[model samples]
Target: MKNIRNFCIIAHIDHGKSTLADRLLHFTGTISDRELQEQTLDDMDLERERGITIKSHAIQMDYTVNGEKYVLNLIDTPGHVDFSYEVSRSIAACEGALLIVDATQGIQAQTISNLYLALEQDLEIIPILNKMDLDSAMAEEVTDQIVELIGCNPEDVIPASGKTGMGVEEILQAVIDRIPAPKGDPEAPLQAMIFDSVFNSFRGIIAYFRIKHGTIRKGDEVKFVNTGKKYHADEIGTLKLTMTPKKVLSAGDVGYIISGIKQAKEVKVGDTITLVSRPCQDVVKGFEDVKPMVFAGIYPVDTDEFEELRGSLEKLQLNDASLVYEPESSMALGFGFRCGFLGMLHMEIVQERLEREFDMTVITTVPNVGYRAMTTKGELLVVNNPSDLPDPSTLASVEEPFIKAQIITKSDFVGQVMTLCINKRGVLTNQVYLTADRVELSFEIPLGEIVFDFYDKLKTISKGYASFDYHPIGYKESKLVKLDIMLNGDQVDALSALIHRDNAYELGKRICLKLRELIPRQQFEIAIQAGIGTKIIARETVRALRKDVTAKCYGGDISRKRKLLEKQKKGKKRMRQVGNVEVPQEAFLAVLQLD
Candidate 1:
C-alpha cells in the first residue's frame, strides 16, 4: 500500500467537484469510454437536476505514473454549507484534500469555511484554481488570494479546467506528491471510521469507510464501538466509479463493507467498525454533527400516499444521514414526518427527491426555526415543529437562533443589500471594501429571516454578482409571538408560528393575500385571518364560489364526469375542510413567497 493515496475533492457549490471526480475516474481508466457519462458522481436524479452533490461518493482507481502503478481512492463531497457536517465526515476518511477555487469567481463563503475545516484536521492541501477555460477566468488574481488566504505556495496552484480536462494529470501528480500515504500498521487490530453507509435490498446494509488499521476478508466478525453491536461481514467490496462491484478492500483503502444490518439506525456516521477480538487504541472522529436549522412537516397531497411518502423519506435517508425526521401527527394535517433540514436548498432537494423518486406529490408546511420556550410549568422546551408549540397563556419566553452573515458585492449594490437585510430585521454589524468594485458587508440576522430565500433576494439586489455565507451565532431573546391563523372563525391548528413583533402586520397581510390566491372561490364565503393571541391584525374574504360544477356531468358523459370528480377529489385532497370551501397547501407556501 506504499503507492496508495486517499484524498477528497472540496469546493463551493457549482465549483465542479463532481465533474472533476468524473474526469479523474476517466483519466485513471476506472470508467470505460462506452460507460462514461457526465457528472458521474451525481448518481441521483435530484442531484443531477439540481446540479449539486448531496452525498459523499467514493471510488477506487489505479493509475500508472512513470510506469509505476498507484491506487488513488477518490471521495467526492458536497459543497453546500448545510452539508458541512457531511463534508467533515468525508474529509475524515481521507488524509488529503484538493481545494478547488473558481478561477473567475475566486473564493466563496463555503470555500473559506471548508478550508478552515481542512486546516483543523491538519490534512495535506493541494489548492487548484478551476474554470480556467471560462471567459471570466482570472488565474493570477485567484492564485494571489489563495496565497494570502490559505497560505499556499503561489507556484503550487495548478490551473486546470475540469470541463476541458486541462492540467488534470498535474492534479493527480500533486496528490501523489503533496498528500502523504496512509501509515497504519496492517498487522494491528481491525479499526475503521464509518464515514458513510447505504442500505441494500438484497445484502441488508453496506458501510463505507477508510480502514485505519488491520484488514479482514469475508465472514469476519466485527464490532461497532459506539453501538457495541457485533456482526459478521456478510460481504466485502470496493466501489468502482462505474458503479460496478469488486471483490475485496484493504487497509489504507476507501470502499464499502456490506453486512446483515438492514436498518439505518444500526449504522451511523462517526461510528467505528472494528474486529471483535482486536481493536485499535483510538477511534477516529467520524464526522461533525450536522444540525437541521429549518424544520418543516412533509404531508402527502393525497393522504392515501402516506405509505409512499414514508418510503421516499426512507430512501432519502439511505445516503443523506444528515436529514433528521420524526413521525409528526397534526389535528388538521393528519400524520407526517417533521423533517429537519440544513437550509432552504437542502429542504428543496428533499422535496424534489420525494416527488421524483417516489412519484408522489407532497405538501410541506412553512419552514420554522427551532425555538426555545419556557412554559408556565417552568419546563424549557425546544420546539422545532410549529405544530408542537404550546398555548400563548402557557408561554413564558422564546428565543430564536441568530447568524453572522457576510456579503460580498459590488459597491453600487451594497445599499440595496443592506436595505433588504434591514427589512428582514437584520442588524448591520460592519462593512469593508474588499476591492474597488467589491465591498464586504456583515450582519447579525435572525436565522429564520434568511431561511426563506434571503440568498435569492441578495442576488436579485446585487444583480447576481454577490457572494454570501453565514454561520450560526447562537440564540438571542426577542419580542416574538405565535401568529395564529383563523379561517371562517375557526382556528387552524397547523397554521401558527413564532414571529417578531415588528413584522407581524406585513406577515399578516401577506398571508391573507396568499390565501386568497391559493384557496379557489367556493359557494361559501371563506374568512382568512392573521392573528396574534386573541387579536386579529389582518383579514381577507374569499368571495363565495360562483360556478364550479359543469352541466356536462349531468348530461351523462360518464368519462368526463369521472374525470371532473377525480380533479375535484385531487383538489379537495390538498384542502382542509373548514366549514365549507377548501384550503390548500399552496396557501401555506404563498405566505412564504415575497412578491
Candidate 2:
C-alpha cells in the first residue's frame, strides 16, 4: 500500500483536464504514442463533439522511480457545475486531487468550487498551471490566483502544457512525494466502496470500486451491503486503457468486478461491497446522497414504449447515480417518468443520451424546480410537477428554492451581468475584486429563475468570459403562481409551469406566441391561451389549414359562392369543437428557449 496512490484531476470546463490525462498516460507509458489521441479518457462521442467531459473516467497507471515500481489510480472528473456530483464521487475514492487551472483564464468559478469539494474531503491538493504553451498564457497572474485560492506556496505550482507534455515528470514526482498512500488491513474482512458502475449487454452490470480492506479474488462470493443480494465475482480486473484481469486485488487498490447480475437496481452507487463468506462487520460510509435541483417529465412519443423507457432509464441510472426518477402520468403525455436532474444541462444530456444511446424517442416537458407548499391544513407538501400542486384555495403559500450563485467575470461586463441577474429577481449579496480587471460577484437568486436560459444569457453578455457556479441555499417565500396553457379550452398539463407572479403576464404572452409558431396548422383552428386559474392572461391563434371553397364556384352565381363559404364555416366550427389539437414535440422544447 505504500507504493499505491489514488488521486483525481479537477478543473474548470475547457481547462485541459482530459488533455492533461492523455499526457499523464503517455508519460507513464500506459499507452503507446501510436495509440495516443486527444481527450483519450473521454470515450463518449457526445463529450468529444461538445468538447466537455460529461462522465468521470478512472484508469490505473504504473510509474517507476529509481527502480521502485508504484501504482497510481487516476480518476478524471468533469468540470461543469451541472456535473459536480461526478467530481464529488471521484473525490470520495481518492486521497489527493490535481487542481489544474488554465493559464489564460485564472481561477474561474468552477475552479474555486471544485477546490472546496477537495478540501472538504481532506484530499492533498497539487496545483498545476495548465495551457502554458499558449501565446496569451498568463502564467504569473494565474499562479498568484492559485496561490491565493489554495494558500499554497508559489513555487509549489507546476507550469505545464497538456498539448506539449511539459512538467509531466514533475507532476509524477509530486504524486509520489506529496500524496500519501492508501492505508488498510489486507488481512481483514473484505470491504469496498462502489463509486461507479456501467452496464454491458454481453455480460451484466460491472461495478468499479476501491477496496478499503482485505482482498478480492477472481471468483469470490460477494454481497452488496445496500441490497443484501449476493453473487459470485465472474471477473475481477484493474481499469487501464482496457480491462486488465488480475488474480487478486488487495486493499487500497481500485478495480472492477463483474458479478453477472442483470438487474440495474441491485447494484447501487455509494453501496458497500463485502464478501459473503467473511463479510466486514462495519460498512464504509461511501458518500452523500445526490440531491436533484431540477425536475421534468420524460415521456415516450409512442405510448407502447413505456416499459422500454423505464428499462433504459434504469440502465442509465446505473451509469449516472445523480439521476433520480419516479413513475408519473401526464394527462397530455401519457405515461412517463418525472426525472430529477442536477441542472438544466444535466437534463439535456440525459435526454440526448436517451435518443442516441438507447434509440428512444421521448418528449420532455418544461423543466422546473421542486417546490414546497404549505397547505391551509398546516401540512407541508412537496410538489415536483405543476400539476401536483394542491388547489389554490387550499394552498397557504408556495416556497421556491433559492441558490447562492457565484459569477466571476471581467470588470467591464460586471454591470451587464448584474443587470441580467437582477432582472431574474436576484439580489447582489457581495462583490470582490480578484484583481485590477477581474471581479467575483455573489448573488442570492431563486433556482427557478435560472432554470430556463440564465446560463446561456450570462455567457452571451460576457462574451463567453464569465464563469458561473451555484449551490442551493434553502427555500424562501415568493409570489409564485402556476401558469396553465389551454388549447381549445382544454388544459395541457405538460405545457403548464409554476412561475413568479410579476413575470407571469410577459412570460405567458411569450410562450403563447412561441407556441403559435411551433404547433403546425391543423384542419381546425387552435386557440392557445395562457391562464392563471380561470382568468386568461394571454392568447394566440393558430389558424386552421384552409381549403379554398370559393375556387369551385369561380364565375358562378354570387349565392353559390356565399352558400359554399357558409357551409365551410359550419364545418370548421364543428371540427374545432370535437378535434383535439396535437401539440408538436418542438413546442415544449421551444418554450424553454423563448427570449
Candidate 3:
C-alpha cells in the first residue's frame, strides 16, 4: 500500500493530455507495440474523430524504481468545459494530479478551471510542460506561466514532449516521490466510492471505484449506501488494457466490480460501496451532482419507439451520470424526454452517441437555459422550456442564469473578442495581461447567450487562438421574452425559445428565414411566423405547389381559362385550411444551426 500512487491527468482541450497518457502507458510497458494506437485512452469512435476526450478513463500501471515495485492508478480526463464534472469526479478518486500545460499555447481557461477543481479536492498537483518537441514550443515562457499560476518553483515543472516520450522517466519518478499513497485501515469496514461505470450487455453493469477503507473480495455481498441496493461482487479486478480478475482489492486501489446488475439505476456513480457484512459508518463524500447548463427535448422519430428510447437512455445514463432527463410529451413532437446537458457540445455528443451506439433515431429540440420566473403571488417557478413560461402579463420579473466567463487570447484579437462578447450582452468585469502579448479577459455574461453559437463564433473570430471557460455566478433579473414559432396559426412548442427582449426580433427574423429554406413546399401555402405575446415579430411563407388547371387549355378562350383558374383558386383556399405540414427532421436541426 505504501508503494501505491493514484493520480489523474488534467489539462485544457488539445493540450496533449491523451498523448502524454499514451506515452506513459507505452513507456511503462502496460501496452505492447502491437496494441498501441493514437489516443488509446479515448475508446469512442466519436472521440477519436473529433480529437477530444469525452469521458474520463482510468487505468493501472506497474513500475519498478530503485529495486522496489510500485502500482500507479491513472485517470485521463476530458478537457472541455462541458466535461468538467468528469474531471471533478476523477479528482475525487485520486491522491495527486498532473497539471499538463501546452508549451505552444501556455495556460488556457479550461486548464486554470480544472486546476482549481483539483486544488479544492486538496490533491497534490505536479505541473508538467508538454509539447516540447514542436518547433513553436515556448518552453521557457510557458514554464514561467505555470510557476506563476500554480505558485510552484521553476525546477518543479518538468519539460516533456508527449510525441517523443521525453522526460517519461522523470514523470514516473515524480509520481513515486511526490504523490502520497492512499491512507486507510485494512481492518476497517469496507468503503469505496464508485467514480465511474459502464454498461455491458453480456456481463451487466460494471462499476469502477476506488477503495477508501478495508478490502473487498469476490463473492462478497456489497451494498450501495445511496441506492440501498445489495449485490454480490461477482468479479473484482484492476483496469489495465483489459480487466484482470483479482481475488481481493484493498484500500487505495482503483478497480472494477461486476455483480450482474442489469438495471442502470441500481448502480449510481459517486455512490458509496460497502460490504453488507461490515458496512462503513460514514458515506463517501464524492463530488457533487452534475449541474446541467443546457436543456433540450429528445424524442424518438417514431412515437411507438418511446419505450425503447427510455431503455436506451437508462443504459446510457449508467455510462454518463452527468446526463439528467425526465419524461415529457409535446403537442408537436409527441412523447420525448427533456434532458439537461453540460453544454451545447455535450448535448451534441449525447445525441450523436445515442444514434450511433443504440440505433435510436431522435429529434432534438431547440436548446435553452433554465430560468427562474417569479409569479405575482411571489411563487418562484423553474422554467426549463419556453412553453412553460407564464403569461407576460404576470406581475413579476424573470431572472436568467448568468456565468463568469474567462477568455484567454492573444492581444491582436482582443478588440474583436471584446466586440463579440459585448454583442452577446456581456459586461466586462476585469481584464489582466498575463504577458505582454497574451491577455485574460473576464466577463459576466448571461448563460443563455453562450448556449447556442458563442463557442463556434469565438473560435472563428479569434482564428482558433482563444479559449473560453465559464461557471455560473447566479441569477440576475433580465428583460426576457419567450419567442414562439407558429406554423399555420398553430404554435410549434418544440421550436420555441426564451430569449432576451433586445435580441428577440433579430433572432426571430433569422429563425423565420432559416425555417423558410428548410421546410419543403406543401400542397398549400405555409406561414412561418415568430411571435412574442401575440405580436408577430417576423414572418415567412412557403408558397403552395400550384397545379395549373388551365395548363390543359392553353389554346382555349381567355374567359374560359379565367373561369377555370378561379375555380382552382377556390379549391386551393379550401385545401390550405385542412392541409397539414410535415416538418422534416432537417428543419428542426436547422433551427439549432441558425447563425
Candidate 4:
C-alpha cells in the first residue's frame, strides 16, 4: 500500500478537468472504449448538456508500472467559483492534486485561485499541461508559466493531451513518483472525514470518505463527531474505479460506507466519522456548509406536474446536496419551488436537467441575489425571494452581496476589461502585470453584477483571451432602489429588483426588451414598464399574442390535445392571480437574456 496515491484534477471552467479525468479512467482500464461516454465522471445529464461539472465525482483506478500495482483514487472537482466550497471539500480528501493547465491558455485566473486553495491545504501539486493536441497549443510556454507560477522545475511539468492520450503514461508515472503516499496510523482509533454523500432511497445514505487513521469495517458502530449520532455500518465497498465494486476498503482508501442512514442531513459533506468503540479526541476541520448565492423560483409549466417536479428535486438532491429548494406559492404562478444555487450556471444546469432527465416542463423566475435588508422597524431581513421583500415605505436600509473579482488576461485588453468592470460599479482595488503579456486586475464588484454574463463579457472584451475568478467579499451598503414593473396598476412581484442608481435606466430598458421577446402575442395589449421610485424609466408595448392557441384539434390526437390544454391550464395556475391578464412563463426570463 506504500505505492498507493490519491489526487484530484483541478482547473477552471472549460480548462478540461473532466476530459482529463475521462482520459485517466480509460488509460487505467477503468472503463472500456465502448462503454465510455465523454467525460464519464460527469454522469449527470445537466453536466453533460452544459459541458461543465457541477458536482465532484470520484473513481478509483489500478495501474501497474514495472509490474508494481498501485491504486490511484482520482477525483474530478468543480472548476466554477460557485462550487468553490464543494471543490475544497473534494480536495480535502486527497493528498495531492493534478493541477491541469490549458496549454493554449496558460495559468488562468481560476487556475491560480484553485492552486492557491490546494497550496493552503498543503497538498503536493503535480502540474500537468493539457490540450497539446490543439492546433494553437503552447506546451513549452505553458510549462514555463507553470514553473514560474509554482516555482517548480519546468521539466517536471507533464505535458499531456487528454484528448488523444498523448503523454498520459508519463502523467501516470509522475503521479506515482511525485504524489506522496497517504500517511496515517491504521492501528489507531478509526477517524475519517465525510467529504461527500449520495442518498439512495433503496441503499440509504452512501457516504464517501477518506480514512485518516485506523480501520472501519462492516457492522462496526460509528459516531458522527459533530452530530453524535451513531450507526452500525451495514456494508463497506471500494470503487474499483474500473466501473465496478470491491469488497472492502481500509485506511487511506477512498470509498463509500453505507449504514442504512436515510436522511442526507445526518452525514454532511464535512462531518467527521469515527468508531464508537475507541473514539478519537482530535476533530478534523470540515468544509463549511455551502450558502447559495443565486436564487430563482422554479415552477412546473403544468400545475398538475407539481408533484412530479418535487419528486424530481428529491431525486436530484440525492446526488447533489448543493441543489436546494423550498415550497414557494405564487399569486400568479401556483405552487413552485424557491430554488437556491451557487450561481446562474448552477441554476440553469438544474433547470435543464429537470426538463431533459425527468421530461418535466418548468418555468423559472429571473435569477437574483439574496439581499440583507435593514428595515425601519429595526428588523434584519435576509431575503432570498423578491416576493419576500417588504414594501418600500417599510424599508430603512438595504445592502447586497459583493465579490472580489480577479482577472488575469493579456495586456492588450486591460482598458476594455477595466471599462466593463467600472460600468458594473466595480472599484479597482489593485493591478499588476503578472508577465510581459499578462496583467492581473482586481476589483470589488457586486456579486449580482458579475453573475450574469460577466464571464462572457470578459471573454468578449479580451477577444477570448481573458479569464476571471471571483469569491464573495461580503456585503456593502450601497445607494440602492427596488425597481418594480406594474403590468397594469398592480406590481408584478416577479419583475422586481434591487438596483444601483446609475444602472436603473439601462437595466430597465434591458428588461423591457427582454419582456417583449418573452411575452408572446397576447389576446390583449400588455404594457411593459420599468420604474425607479415612482417614475417609469422604460416602457414597451407587447402586442396581443398571436398564434398561441391552435383552433383545431384532430380526433386521433385527443389525448395529446387534452395534455396540451392541461399544461396551459397548469401554467395559468402558476401565474400570479392578478385581476385579469395572465403572465406567461417566458416573461420571467425575458430580462435575463442579452440576446
Candidate 5:
C-alpha cells in the first residue's frame, strides 16, 4: 500500500488534462509506442473530435523509480460543468488530484469549481501549470494565481508542457512523493464504493469500484447496500486500458468486479458493495444519486420506432446512470420518453449517442427546468413538463429552479456580458477583478433563462473568451405560466413551454412567427396561435397556396370568372373549417431554436 498511489486529473475544459494523461501513459511505458494515440484515455470518438473529455476513465499503471516499484491508478475526468457530479464521484475514489490549468488562459470557472470539489474531498492537490512550450504561456502569473487562490506552496507548483512531454518525469516523481498512499484495512469486512459501472453482452454488469476497507475475490457473494441485491462475483479484474482478470483485489485498490447481474439498473454508481456473508456493519459515506437538472422529451421521428428508442435509452442508461427517462405521450408527436439530463451538453451528447451508437433518429423537444407547482388543495408538486402543470385555478403559486452562475471573462467585454446576463433576468450577486484584464462575475439567474442559448450568446458577446459554470441554488417564486401553441385551434402539447408571465406575449409572438416561417402552406389556411391557458397571447397565419380557379376560363366573361372565383372561395372557407393542419417535424425543432 505504501507504494500505491491513487489519483485523478482535474481541469477546465480544453485545458490539456487528457494530453497530460497521455503523456503520463507514454512516460511510464504503460502503453507501447506503436499503440500510443493522442488522448488515448478518451474512448469516445465524439470526445476526441471535440477535444474534450466527456466520460471519466480509470487506468492502472506501474512505474519504477529508484529501484522502488509503485502502482499508480489514474482516473481522468471530464472538465465540463455538466459533468461536475461525475468529477466529484471520481475525486471521491482517489487520494490526490493534479489540478491542471492552461498557462495562457489561466484559471476558468470550471477550474475554480473543480478545485473546490477536490478540496471538499480533502484530497492532496498538486497545482500543475501546463502548456509551457507555448510562446504565450504565462507560467509565472498563473503560478502566483494558483498559490493565492488555492493556497498551495509557491515552490511546489509544477510547470509542464503536455505537448512536448516536458517535465513529464518530474510530474510522475511528484505523484509518488506528494500524493499519499491509500490506507485501508485488508482484514476488515468487505466494503467497496461503486464509482462507475459498464454493461457487457457476455459478462453482464461490470462494476468499477474502489475498495475502502476490505478485499474482494472471484466467487465472493457481494451485496449492494442500497438495493440489497446479492450476486456472486463472476470475475475480478483491473483496468489497464483494457480489463485484465485478477483472482483477488486487496484493500485500498481500484478495480472491477463482474457479477452475473443481467440488469444494469441493479448496479448503481455511488452505491456501497459488501460481502453478503460477512457484511460490513456500516457502509461508506458520501454516496448520493445524481439528480438531473434539465428535462426534455425525446421521441422517434417515426412513431413505429418508439419501442426501439425505448430499448436504446435503456441500454444507454445502463452506462450512464445520470440519465433519467420515463414514458410519455404527446398529442402531436405520439408516444415518447420524457428524459432528464445534467445540462444542455449532456442532453445533446445523449441524443447524438442514441443516433450514432444505437442507430436511432430521435426528435428532442424544447428543454425545461423542473418547476414547483402548488395546487389549490395546497399540494406541492414538481412538474418536469409544461403540459404536466395543473390548471391556473387549481394552482396557488409556482416556483422555478434557479442557479448561481459564475462567469470568467476578459474585462474588456464585461459590459457586454453583463448586459446579456441582465437581459436573461440574471441578478448580479458579486463581481471581482481576477487580474487587470480578467474578471469573475457571479449571478443568480433562473435556470430557464439560461438553459436555451445563454451560453452561446455569452460566448458571442465575449468573443469566445468567457467561461461559465453554475450550480442549482434551489427554486424561487416566479410569475411563470405555461404557453401552449395551437395549430388551427388544436393544442400541440409538444410545443408547450413555461415562461415568465411578463415576457409571455413577446416570446409567444416570436414562437408564432418562427412556426409560421417553418410550417408549410397547405390547401387550407392555418392559424398558428400562442396562448396562456384559454387566452390567446399571439397569433400568426400561414396562408394557403393560391390556385388560379379562373385559369380554366380563358377569354371568358368577367361574370363567369367572378362566379368561378366565388365558388372557389366558398370551397376554401369550408376546407379551412374542417381541414387539419399538418405540422412538419422541422417546425417543432425551429421553435426550440427561437431566441
Candidate 6:
C-alpha cells in the first residue's frame, strides 16, 4: 500500500488537465509513443470536438524511481460547472488532487469551485502552474495568487509545461511522495464504492469501483446495498487504457466489476457494493441521488420514430445516470419525452447525441427550471413544464428556483458585467478584490433568468475575460405568469414559457418579432400573438402571399376587374377564418433563442 498513489487532476476548462494526464501516461511508459493520442482520457468524440472533458476516466499506471516500483491511479475529471458532481465523485475516490492553473489565464471561476470541493473532501492538494512554455505565461504572478488563495508555501508550487512535457517526471515524483497511499485492512468485510458504471451489450452492467476494505475476486457473489440486488462477479479487471483482466483486487485497489446484471437501472453510481455471503453491517455513507436542474421536452421530427427515440434515450441514460425522462404529449408536438438535465450544456449534448449517434432528428422545447406551486387547498406541487402549471385560481403562490452566482472578472469590465447581471434580475450580495485588477462579484439570481443566454452575454460584455459559476440556493417567491403563443387564434403549448410579470412586455415583443421573421408566409395572413392568461401583450402578422386576381385579363372592362377583386377579397377572408397556420420547426427554436 505504501507504493500505491491515487490522485486526480482538477482545473478550469481549457486549462490543460487532459494534456497533463497524457504526459503522465507517456512518461510512466503506460503507453508507447505510437499509441499515445491527444486528450487520451477524453474518450468521447463530443468531448474532443468541444475541447473539454465531459466524462471522468480512470487508468492505472506503473512507474519506477531508483529501481523502486510504484502503482499510480490517475483519474481525469471534467472542469465544467455542469459536471461538478462528477468531479466531486472522482475526488472522493482519490487521496490527492493536482490543482492545475494555467500560467497565462491564472485562476478562473471553476478553478476556485474545484479547489473548495477538494478541500471539502480533505484531500492533499498539489498546486501546479502549467503552460510554462507560452511567451505570455506569468508563472510568478500565478504562483503568488495560488499562495494567497490556498495559503500554501511558495516552495510547494510546481511549474510544468504540458505541451512540451517539461517537469512531468517531477510531478509524478511529487505524486508518490506527497499523496498518501490508500490504507485499508484487506482482512475486513468486503466493502466498495461504485463511482461510475457503463452498460455492456454482452457482459451486462460493468461497475467501476474502489475497494475500501476486504477483497473482491471473480465469481464472488456481490450485492448492491441501495438496491439490494445480488449478482455474481463474472469478471474483475484493472483499467489501463482498456480493461485488463485480473483474478483478484484487494483493498486500496481500484478496478471494474462485471456483474451479470442485465438491467442498467439495477446498478447506480455512489452505491455500495458488498459481498452477499458476508454482508457488512452498515452501508457506506456520502451517497446522494442526483437531481436534474433543467427540464425540456424532446420529440422526434417524425412522430412514428417515438419508439426509436425512447430506446436511444434509455441507452444514453445507462451511461449518464444524471439524465431523467418520462413520456409527455404536446398539442403542438405530438408524443415525446420530457427530459431533465444537469444544465443547458448537458441538454444540448443529449440532443446532439440523439441526432448524431441515433440518426434521429428531434425537436426540443424551451428549457425551463422547476417551479413550486402552492394550491388553494394547501397542496405544494413541483411543476417542470409550463403546460403543466395549474390555473391561477387553483394556486395560492408560485415560487421559482434561484441560484447564488459568482463572477470573476477584470476590474475594467466590472460596471458592464454588473449591469448585465442586474438586468437578469440578480441582486448583489457581496464583492471582493483578489488583486488590483481582478474582482469577484457575487449575486443571487433566478435560475430562469440565465438559463438561456446569460453566459454568452456575460462573455460579450467582458470581452471574454469573465468566468461565472453558480449553485442552486433555493426557491424564491416571484410574480411569474405563463406566456403562451397563439397562431391564428390557436394556442401552441410547445411555445409556452413562464416569465416574471415585470419583463413580460419586452420578452413577449422580442419573441413575437423573432417568430415573424422565422415563420414563412402562407395563403392566408397568420396572426402571431403572445399573451399572459387572457391579455395580449405583443402581436405580429405574417402577410399573406398575394396573387394578382386579374393578371390574365388584358384590356378588360373596369367592372370585370372590380368584380374579380371583390371575389378574391371574400375568398381570402373565408380562408383566414378557417385556415390553420402550420408553424415551421425553425420558428419554435427561434423563439427559444430570443434575446
- For model 1, state the Cα shift of residue 336 in Å: 0.9
TM-score versus the correct structure, for each prediction = 0.90, 0.97, 0.97, 0.86, 0.97, 0.95
lDDT value, candidate 1, whole model: 0.82
TM-score of 3: 0.97
- Residues 35-145, candidate 6: write the lDDT tens digits: 899998888899989998988999999999999999999999999888887898898789999999999999999999999999988899999999999999988889999
Over 329-357, each residue of candidate 4 has an lDDT whose tens digit, in order, gives 87767888999898877787788778877
- Residue pairs with backbone overlap in model 3: none
Model with the higher TM-score, candidate 1 or 2:
2
Candidate 4 residue runs with Cα over 4 Å from true position = 33-37, 133-135, 225-229, 242-248, 304-308, 509-579
Candidate 2: where are CA atoms >4 Å away? 545-567
Candidate 2 lDDT tens digits, 303-332: 999999999999999999999999999989
For all the candidates, what are their Cα RMSDs to the real structure?
Answer: 6.8, 1.7, 1.5, 8.1, 1.7, 2.0
TM-score of 2: 0.97
Task: Name the weakest run of 10 consecutive residues (lDDT summed) in model 6.
Answer: 282-291
Query: How many residue-pair clashes does candidate 3 contain?
Result: 0
Stretches of candidate 6 off by over 4 Å are 550-579
Clashing pairs in 5: none
User: By the TM-score metric, which is better: model 2 or model 4?
Assistant: 2
Candidate 3: stretches off by over 4 Å = 551-563
- Give lDDT: candidate 6, residue 332: 86
Residue pairs clashing, model 1: 522-545, 523-545
Q: Model 2, residue 95: what's the lDDT?
A: 96
Q: Count clashes in each candidate, considering only residues at least 3 apart in sequence or on different chains.
A: 2, 0, 0, 17, 0, 0
